[model samples]
Target: MGERGVQVGGRAVLPGALRPWLGGIAGLGAVVLFGLGVLFAGDSRPGVVDLRVWAVVNGAAPPWLYVAQAMDFLGEPVGAPLLVGATVVGCLLLRRPRAAVLVVLGVGVTVGVAKVLKSLVGRTIHGDNLSFPSGHTAFFTSFALVVALLVAGWLRVGRTVGVPLVLASTLLAAAVMGWAQVVLGAHYPTDVVGGWCTAVAVVPVVAWGVDRVADGRR
Candidate 1:
């Protein structure tokens, strides 16, 4: 199975033999664990983890405060959705409908799951609404993940460069977005972590769906 995986245009695309069932199950398991952990920890008031992280994030310098505010805008209700829509349209125009659908579902699933879990846990901070998982973090991270996967598949920069450089840059962007949410006092560390975990949990499932659809057509 491992030997069957092939490189296309310098990018490694896993073989269809791996199957969607396995990836879907694995991804679902991770999502369950993340949801359970967040709900359990947030059942009561803010715990030590929340407080400590909150302190660190809130202790940022004035310049960092400005940066955080700027980064915050990137995921505002309008900006993130607009970017996602544009990406989806671009993929569709490129004749990759599967990729476009994956991008759309990727953001939708991540954000939807975050909202559901936040409501179920009923966690709030400083008398505000649910904030268990940072939606901003999830939005940007999921976008980055889907975009990276599609772009990497489309543009082959060799395994040596593509796998290391492209993947690293995508992750760095996600991390920076998460950090911005934390530094801006928009979310606790756990919230940011949960958001990231949500995106990680979602992207694979979406990819698996795309693969299954493609395989069925073939």
Candidate 2:
């Protein structure tokens, strides 16, 4: 290769190398923001918020408080099995089995980090229930949004219309999940926002990995 060809290729390689580092920084930012929110929110908002009002407005639970707490303990709204099903559907439809695997890994990593962070840096809800960045919100948003991105690009949606539509719908779903997180007292608004920022960081990187895996298989 000529000198110019070598120089251009070297620079292109540098940009590609930086991409993963940038992604890690974004994930770290999510943790920091979530920590800050928890620190500043101390003694300001109720940790669990207003349960009766939420129940009345959302028709969310049984008349019994124990029953509601029981449901929360069981993770009624965003059940693990349901989330797994959605992830599976998205991965299969997009022909990216590896993306599903990556998602599981991402979620596992996030949960571990969240638990550790919650104990070390953030707030204690109950005796041991850590309540900083909501794991449920992060997982759902990350999984849903990243899957949307993968499907959009995998379909080769043109910039003119299809791609934008995919994004719009993805944002809508993310929004609903965020709202649910807050209303259900699983998270504060900022916790959900931080989770989104985290998702923006991890999802794309994971999707890229999945895409490459799928492409290689083909």
Candidate 3:
């Protein structure tokens, strides 16, 4: 598709020219593998890697703790909706309705899946709080993915540039959220990994589906 030809149904949808579906597939595989590992490890206990990472991240200096709390707030009830709403409004202003829909579905579905998986995995931290996949991490990562995809589409960049842009954005968001979750004692390091992977597994497919539906209607 040409740069301007990427539109569907007279709206600027996801750029179908860039190939993110392959990354989506790999993400799904990672989620499954991580889930199986969680199951095998049983409940409420940190793995070897989790222990090491947690040891490093769980305790923080006072100043750094404040920074972590600020980052954590972005995933909290008050902050999350604000972020999502802002992104949706921004997409609408840019005339990218499909991208706006994607931001909604991407964040909602990713966080929803994390919640469901917490029940299925039955992993707990700090007593009865389920924490297999950190919902906060998933929320931020999903939002980041949607934003990156929208930016890539807007820039009309191809896989060579788009892929790196998306990956870098995703990794940065995930790392920040993951650190906050760990530092706050909300989840283990592996739980943060699961949440990050969930967003990676979900957002591209959601984008593709949005594009497919828009194209079908057209």
Candidate 4:
């Protein structure tokens, strides 16, 4: 519907609004496609095997493995968690409690849903059933979304320019993180796509709903 901006770090930023809906739909599409790939093709198929082989091959390179290791660290506590935790605290300090709450809930739901889907789907890699969805990818995607929304709301920059810039940059970073997971043999391609979809599907809806409730209260 309508768009609004909040102040963060002394700049105006836009909260979750239309972008969330658009992103949610796009993400849902990815999830659906990949879920079908997983269900119909099964893990032993050529598509899955080929991608995994490529990742393993490229990953053997010193440079690629180094990059994967670095990206892997980001998904850890000192990386995504630290970044998200700090961002949440920043939103609270800036008096945007709803944004902070959205960050927490969005990430929580993304992780929780990923876990459930992985369990139900029962895809395995390296003897781990959790391979159906890459938790690292989801975490990084949610982290990017939080930062993007926070920056949009904090900067007075027009949504037309700011939203696209933030989204593009964040999505690129998220993609890199997903690639790293694949390179490290941590997940299948479908798993990484599934993770990205989870964040897209969950974050926007939850953020929008939180904003709506906050508006109702006001």
Candidate 5:
């Protein structure tokens, strides 16, 4: 079997190929939860959950605060391009053009969707800054998701292992970014959750689309 699994009708068919769709279903459910969060956070006031998380995640020591600041920078203009560009180059070096494309689309589209949702939801923090979905959280999570999918493909891992790996990687990345955003007071906890869900809901679908289009062309 190849890195992408067996090719059938020009499509890469992985072991337990149907299993990844389960993640898609779970992602949709998370999106629903995020929608509810938006409704509650639209007033720009932190809810009970947000406050609870804030109390725990906020107020770091100078050292940890610096770490969080560095994490924050990774999602900013200067850091984002450098990080993503390096990943894209790495994918290409590995001769995985599809993975390279995914790295771009997954992160770009996830962040774009978050921005759109911010305007639509009108959830704000620290004055008028829109914060419905934390774009920083979404960016890192989506990037992780893409990397996880690429790893699964390259290793030819089945759904049993692949799904958990992808979910875990995404969650880990989201948590780190979410913590940083909360610590920095850039977003409410609910905003971070929404951002995480946005990446979950978006990346898999984009992957599927990329596969379909690539397969069709083949």
Candidate 6:
């Protein structure tokens, strides 16, 4: 099945067949869980309570809110420009042009599918919907995950060099973006979960498909 996802030290195994099928499975689980939360969050009051809990934990005023909203400092498409460029460069550098193209497709699918899920379920966003499975969160997460995983394998350096540092920082950025989504009230918790699920599933599955094609061509 040519399972090759997020390899670490040449020994890392994908959690599944590293195929589209597995990605679909992961995605479905995420959707089901989100639906359950929507259906049985007790009631609107309960939902509000849960949100308030997060608000308190995030502090009376989340710094991310200011950071996200300050358009003059940082406009929309926060990561889009960087992501497009990075995906292209990463593909070229890795000699995985097909994988790179597939990643773009995968990200597109994530956004499209998220919209379908939101509309089909008619799940009203506590924050906003058209907002189910936060596109911004998913988009940035996919960006980080793709860059991290793609570059991770090729990063060979002297043993003394900190190989894991870059990957860790990328992952940390994704985490921060997810936190920002929550703090900014751009998405609810479930929306963030859905966003993450959409990304991991799509990227690995798409990459797996790309690998098959590239290997065949070779």
User: Which digits, one per residue and each the tens of the lDDT, describe model 2 over residues 1-218?
Assistant: 11232133111111232344435655766667666665644333443443433554453444444444543443334575576667777776866556566667555555555455555545535344556666665666565555554454445444454445534644565466655665555665555555555555555455444444444423
Global lDDT scores for all candidate models = 0.66, 0.51, 0.79, 0.67, 0.78, 0.53
CA lDDT of 145 in candidate 2? 56
Candidate 4, residues 10-30: lDDT per residue as tens digits? Answer: 222235344544565657656
lDDT of 1 by residue, 1-218 (tens): 23222332222232233334335534764776466565655554656777886776665687887888777887888777788889888987987776777888878888898788787766676675677777888788778767766666676444554445434644676678878877766676777767776776776666655555545423
Worst 10 residues of 1 by lDDT: 3-12
Model 2 clash count equals 0
> Which runs in model 3 stand beyond 4 Å of their true positions?
1-5, 20-42
- Our tally of clashes for model 1 stands at 0
Better of 1 and 5 by lDDT: 5
Candidate 3 lDDT over residue span 79-187, tens digit each:
9999999989988898878888999998998889888877777888888888878899889988988888888877887778887887788789989999988988888
Q: Mark the regions of model 6 whose C-alpha exceeds 4 Å error after superposition.
A: 3-49, 57-64, 70-79, 93-95, 126-128, 156-174
Instruction: Give the C-alpha lDDT of model 1.
Output: 0.66
Residues 82-174 of candidate 5 have per-residue lDDT tens digits of 999999999889777777888898899899988988887888898889987889998999888888877787787777788888879988998
RMSD of 6: 6.4
lDDT of 6 by residue, 1-218 (tens): 44342342232212222233445555775666466446634332225644764766463254645765541122145546555767687676866665566557666665666667666545454533455565665666666655554444345322233224433533465456656666665556555666666666566665555555544523
Residue pairs of candidate 5 with colliding backbone atoms: none
Better of 2 and 6 by lDDT: 6
- The all-Cα superposition gives candidate 5 an RMSD in Å to the true structure of 3.2
Question: Considering summed lDDT, which 10 consecutive residues are worst modelled in model 6?
Answer: 8-17
The estimated TM-scores of all candidates read 0.74, 0.57, 0.89, 0.77, 0.89, 0.64
Q: What value does the lDDT take at residue 130 in candidate 2? A: 57
